[model samples]
Target: MEDLMQKATEATDDLYRIRDTYFPKDVNHKINTLQTHSQIALNILDSIPLEERKLATQRATYEYLRGKILDVFEEYSKKAEDHLSKAVKLNPSLADAWLCLGNCIWKKGDLPATRNCFTLALSKGPNKRILSQLSMLERRMAQGAENQEEIVAESIKHAKEAIALDVKDGNSWYNLGNACLTCFFVTGAWDHSKLQQSLKAYQNAEKDEGMKMNPDLYFNCATVNTYLENYERALSGFEAAALIDPCLNATEEVKKMINLVDKLDGLLKGQIKAKRLASLTSSLTEVQVKPSYKRATIDNLLDGLNKAIAVVGKVLFFIKHENITPLYYLVCDSNQICFVLTVYGMSNEAIKEGDQVTLLDPCFRNNNFSWNEKHYELRSIRVDFLEQVQVNGKPIPPRHSVRSSIYAQHKP
Candidate 1:
């Protein structure tokens, strides 16, 4: 019976490890393997004499292993729930059984009950794995909630607690990074500090040798790098993720970045004639800024928070992306310097090509990278609020303001 129990435990661990790292192509084969392992465990448990398994501790162990195997299925299994509940009732000290019960309940969409299970599991003792699961649950709860920031902050807190338990645990660090990244998006993508913290967490996660098989780590780290305009790192990271999991969207992201670079390069080099450039550069005149606003140029921009300032430019052309917030456009300043301009908190109709716009408190990045032996350099600026952008010397109407959402990909 002891040897059978050991086999059950090893099978459960192996199933979890495979689930974490396997690619989508392995789904069918993976499910078959899960069933095979589960059947073996079930067979082992049933082979034990009823009298031999009469002890509560022994019976609870038997039920818990069987429950864990059923829980591995993608869909919620009532049988799994029943087995787990019996295990916990038989022996309340089985913390892992509670953990498995929580995971099973999560698939049923009973988030609050799942939380209760995790809380009970933690009450048994401090467990980093349980804490990490709780952290992920908090982040999922935050999605579309009115108190998104508060819940995501709690998620980050729990992730930190998990990390504190085992500083070298790659999975815990990965959870922390994901929580931080979610916070970065939840609070409005303007917070460079959050992105930096997330990147740092991912870097630490990568230090663990076991993390090498996780494609999501590279993909998420690349996402943060993309936001920070670390284009080279972003491309390389996405490439690494794609290599690990071809079914992931990481390859698409790499293609998009390369395509954007190509477009920006063409706009600057192919369209700018000497005569047209002279006419555009000569249209600039003295401009008025907001009462407290200071004037600055792209040449003096910084990475993070900049002084209240306005940099005026002419919208060369609109760069279109599907349903993405912060509309992209190519704009050139008086000196004929071109940069990608991103405006948030407004509809695309708020600005147009040939419009002279004032960018207030612009978030700036100097993006330079080489891909496929081709060199590309881009200066990018982002405006988070509608008020930060002035079209034709006037603020955009409030009717143009819309909550940011990304729902589809289509050409304008």
Candidate 2:
């Protein structure tokens, strides 16, 4: 029994030795070792008298760490949550146990309970890693709230706290990058200052060698570059990310991006028809144009999908819709909505980079928005009005994501 207790304690201690590394394989190996010991400890614990408070408590420590380790996989999350919950109950001072419980429960989609567990863990002892995770989850909740301003404020507050606590924690930096981007989209920051900040934060996170293996990090960096209109850099980033995750269809996206750049180049050199140039730089006021549709916000158009409800938003980036008879635009909005806008030959001339425009009689369709990835609202454009104005003296092309499953089927 004593040997089991010692082994259990040693196993947990081993976890901390490489705790800061971001390598999943290394972490998983340690977790598996800890799991074996914890299971043995639990078996011994089952046979021991419940009245043996000291021994029970010692064994409970193993159960607690075991739960935390199990949280790395979705399959073991329930067991992890159960064991960690019992561990914390057995000894309330086990702050780490509460933290593990928080993670497991969060994976099970209980956000409120996850927050509660993290709060309890914080009360016992402060941990930068735990704080960072809580902050990120808070930001996600805020993103979904209707009163987004209030909730996003809270999220930013927590994210800053996490960064302040740990200057070198890569996860905290990554979370801050995400928070800043969310704020940019939500608040419609004209200068796109937050986008730069997000880029910097992501770069700082990559300074950690272990973070190099993270495909999401590479994808985000690429997206930020797209927003900044750094086409070459964005392409490189996409390529790097694709090297890590072949399933992402990044190679196909790269081809599209290259085609876009070449098309623009052809237009500039008079290689492509002057007609295409009109599509790149046309606007409503420069010519005799009239609108036949009513305007609304993206929030308002959700109820009436496929109806001709106009929505106005600042352009963040543009992607060409391929092979369709009429030219289509995949545009990202500063207001956190992205939609597909169709342009007739003459009207396409008005659609330029960094223009704030309204889509007339735009039809709204759904995109596969899977929680953490970039997604957009698919809409057809009726180009009623276009205002190409500079915001806060800093404007970049709007951002768009095209490597999704939906995009795969379209294949253009």
Candidate 3:
């Protein structure tokens, strides 16, 4: 009998070691070892004399080991329920029995039952750790609900409660930031004020001061800045984020955004010229149209004005939807003969000022005349016609076309 009791004690110690070492890293392995040890201990208990086991020391040890084994090997639910029921019957005041039962139910993923058990455990004493963990689980469950806005509000409430209980918890702050960012994205506003607020909360996480060093935060900031059309700042922020931790996915996304910003910058320069032309034409129409003009001639001019109106309409539509701008420039020679109509904003330069040129279907094609030195690229010119006139006896410089090699080199 004494030998059997000794074997039971050793088996209990082995079970405890398995729980301490394996339970956290691997619940499955811990459960297997625990079941093996518990069977051995139970067989040893059966062999011991009844009178010997009934003593206070032996009875307490048996009950403690039984509860712990039940807690670990939860798959033996029926057997564990039987053992716990018997233990509670024998000792009504055993707090450990109640706690173990509560944890077992938690492992089964029965939250209401688990919360009841935890409440009972807390009834016996104030357990700060258990309370904190329960709050976190509650927050997770709340955030997983269907109504996203309500879930976010509830999550924020729970996170605030967790922080109130333990001010230094990094996870609580991180979770709060998640809730805020979700709200910002769902609204689709990309409001900088709201994002900055969320970022500040994440920055306050207690695990490390280097939460600010996290690449995700910087990438988010870059996206917001890009939406705000602060392209230069967005470019720099994305570059810094990619440098920190160049995951393949993030590297590809940042490269794409950088390319987009470069294209937008070029498109903006072209649109500036278009806007200037629009403004100039508006001013000219106000000053030049007089009531004394003949009706027939005015009607012809109105027809030409309607055509010009259609071109501006197309340009505006492309600018808004496709990020494209149309260019119209006239180039003349020393003899004041207009020889070229250049359009510069397409993927290719349509015409060079010195080239022999012919207009066909709104595009310029080559003509028979040889190129000349008296030609220069106009920086900004619009659709209005110009008559060639000699000025200052100086020959124009040869037009400089933007080269394909330079375009490829400047591309990110």
Q: Estimate each model's TM-score.
A: 0.89, 0.59, 0.36
Summarize candidate 3's per-residue lDDT along 200-303 as a digit string, tens digits.
55657626553444556556555545433344555566776676545513456556545543343334334335444444334222222123322121112231
Ranking by TM-score: 1, 2, 3
> Candidate 2's residue-wise lDDT over 1-412, tens digit each?
5665555556555444334322343446655655565455445545544454366577577567666655645453677777887898888888888887887787767889989988988887667767777766776665545665566566666766777887877777777777666665555332247679888988888887757777677777776765554556778888887877665666776777666545433332334344543444344223221255454555466633335444555453455534322344544433344455534222333456666565545544332222124222233333311232122222223331111112112210
Better of 2 and 3 by lDDT: 2
- Number of clashes found in candidate 3: 0
Off-target runs (Cα >4 Å) in candidate 3 are: 1-146, 188-193, 206-248, 271-276, 279-412
* Best candidate (score: TM-score): 1
Location of the lowest summed lDDT over 10 successive residues in candidate 1: 403-412
Q: Which structure among the candidates has the greatest lDDT?
A: 1
The true-versus-predicted C-alpha distance at residue 17 of model 2, in Å, is: 11
lDDT of 3: 0.45
What number of clashing residue pairs does each candidate have, in the order they appear? 0, 11, 0
Weakest 10 consecutive residues, lDDT, candidate 2?
403-412
Error of 3 at 309 (Å): 29
